[model samples]
Target: MPKLGYTAAQIRAAEAPLLAKGVPLMIRAAQALADHVTSVLPEPSASRVLVLAGAGDNGGDACWAASFLAEAGVQVNVVPVMGRLSPEPEAGARESGARILTEAKPVDAAQLVADADVIIDGMLGIGAGGTAAGGSPALRGTARDWALAVHAALTENPHPLVIAVDLPSGIDPDSGEVAEPEAVIPADLTVTFIGIKAGCLQGEGAKLAGKVWLEPIGASQHLLGVPPAVTVS
Candidate 1:
């Protein structure tokens, strides 16, 4: 396997063709995540899932996956901890006919986050750049606070299994550098999209990544014409 860390730009560029082909990255990501969650769940039949969805595509994925789990008769809660969601992906998850807790339920997310069997950390992704990206002091602070809550819950409560979408909430995807280490919500399993990155393979990023999984999300086409850093014979 190739070892590398993908920048937010690269990941977004890769999504171009797939998005064009009508490939639903969020849906596919969610489905893959849901499948994995199902396999390892101590009791998939009757489990409570708490999805900490941010405002980005990562959050969208968690929302969709929670919807699937909810439909299966599992108790699922979609916590939009911050920001909003993408249109199509959010709509798809809504159609799955699950209960979504908007910003209105911040208290609920905080409570369920402490007592849930599983927590899907979809707070951030590679696209973590621009105004909302590496994170300004304010954004990082928000993420740091979120992390503190999770850490407290994990230590004091049931210590739920965490499955992160893409990178953890406060981590930098391109550089794999962490600003708010305290806010770093380490993943028990990370369902990543496209190819692997440098950060997830080494450094503090590795520990945070935990068990890494790659989903194509139909993004290879975008890399077809681009020159790769390495070419094996």
Candidate 2:
């Protein structure tokens, strides 16, 4: 599909048909992201993973990827934005021996990010809408908010690799617009799934999305009609 400039909803919507056919699109997106996240981890740093999970399915993907990383011996540290995120991926993460960062005192937040070798930015992606409102919006699930707190800390001294699951949080996947993207938490690589959101392909999306790639599970075509013009990626 040429550069269709599709909305986040449209891209995700097109995925519905494929998903219903028992195609593990989420698994592909998760595993594809996992592979990218693994490429940067050195043997020395294989035991440390910092997952900044959001309150959405994208966050779940991050958690799932973390599980894969953990299996490879990476110490996965999952810090959800809210306390207990809905449709949470904690269950899957736990299956891989990953721990969710519970609400803690202010000091503990700093320790988590500093200890992590890799930071998985699972805060938001293409489906992100009213979820990422202000830079520091009210988080749900629990009391302590780790997403913004982590962003603040990472901004000061960012890690070597920031692997965003779908799209970087605070970035519009459809428009590629970043609403005050944290400098401390800029991503080094991004692995988007299903289809490339408009924001991830162009505009500020292009700036935030580094070395973009697709993760389609049995979804080679978006539509079965005349094809659209393509870019020479």
Each candidate's TM vs. the true structure?
Answer: 0.82, 0.80
Q: For candidate 1, what is the lDDT?
A: 0.68
The candidate maximizing lDDT is 1
Which residue pairs in candidate 2 collide? 47-75, 83-142, 155-184, 176-199
Off by over 4 Å in 1: 87-97, 103-110, 130-144, 224-233
Model 1, residue 182: C-alpha shift (Å)? 1.6
Off by over 4 Å in 2: 1-5, 44-46, 86-88, 104-107, 129-147, 223-233
Best candidate, TM-score:
1
Model 2: per-residue lDDT, tens digit, 35-117?
88778777724558878776677787888887788787778888766455435367888877888776553356578777877
Q: Which ten residues in a row have the lowest lDDT in candidate 2?
A: 134-143
lDDT (CA) for every model shown?
A: 0.68, 0.65
Q: State each model's C-alpha RMSD to the native.
A: 3.7, 4.3
